[model samples]
Target: MKTLMYVFIVALGTLACQQEKKIGYVDNGTVINQYQEKRDVEDKFQAREEAFTKRADSISKAFQLEVQQTQIDARKASQKKAQELMQGLQQKQQMLQQQMQFEQQQLSQAFQTEIDSLIIKVKTFVRNYGKDNGYTYILGTSDAAASVLYGTDENNLTQIILDALNAAYQKQ
Candidate 1:
């Protein structure tokens, strides 16, 4: 029994001497928000949204002016001519509305696609980083949700990963 106990102790010591698994956690929101590339993408999308709004506003203003002119002309024109003019204006308004809606949808879809791509890039970068650094796992936590409930400050990789990601983005 004593020999068996010594053998068990030796086995435990051998297992303890094996390599330790590395694990880390990062704040997903912080990393994504502080990432320079994400900020650049958001800025670019904002500019596009502003430009689209301006163009839409200009078109709407021009249409309003045309409607006002048509009303004035209708007052001096024949009943039939006034009816025709009103119908034309209505058709034009409908076409303009449809065009605006289509453009808005296209812009929204494009932005969503870009954002999805960026998210994928972030995930891929984290995976590669873990593989390269020999991390068994790299959990993510956010204010809205968390994959890791508790981790020591030493195991928090958010800042380090964020800095590396930003550097890589700058090089690109």
Candidate 2:
């Protein structure tokens, strides 16, 4: 009985001596959505997307007009000449579509690349923030996969970290 009691006391003392873990959680969606740099990146891409749409629309309209005129010309020509004109028009349309698709791919790729880098940067920022502020762990929570299901408001660092991220971005 004495040995058991002594062992229990020793275990209690050892547990009491261990430091409490400092943990916090941030909502991944909140931080990323509210990040000013990410917003700016999105806005920049939006403008580019608009411009590309306008250019594509203008090109398509011009081509359509050309096609209409060719149809009118073909109506007054020999059947063989009309077929030839249609074949040429079909070729031009296919080439134009290919070119537009390529441009769209390029634009999409560039936007994705920038967004990807920004996410990495945010992750790095959180890691550095954790290290500098003495966090044992800073877990992330998202609707799709919540690493942290429930954290107290006092332990929620979403806004705190977002503010810091924006402040740093503003400085830049």
Q: Estimate, for each residue in 89-129, the C-alpha lDDT of model 2 and write its tens digit.
A: 99999999999999999999999999999999999999999
For candidate 1, what is the lDDT?
A: 0.95
Of candidate 1, the 10-residue stretch with the lowest lDDT total is: 12-21
> How many Å off is the CA of 55 in candidate 1?
1.0
Give candidate 1 regions above 4 Å deviation.
Answer: 1-19
Question: Poorest 10 consecutive residues of model 2 by lDDT?
Answer: 16-25
Model 1 residue 114 CA deviation (Å) reads 1.0
**TM-score, candidate number 2:** 0.91
The alpha-carbon lDDT assigned to residue 62 of candidate 2 equals 99
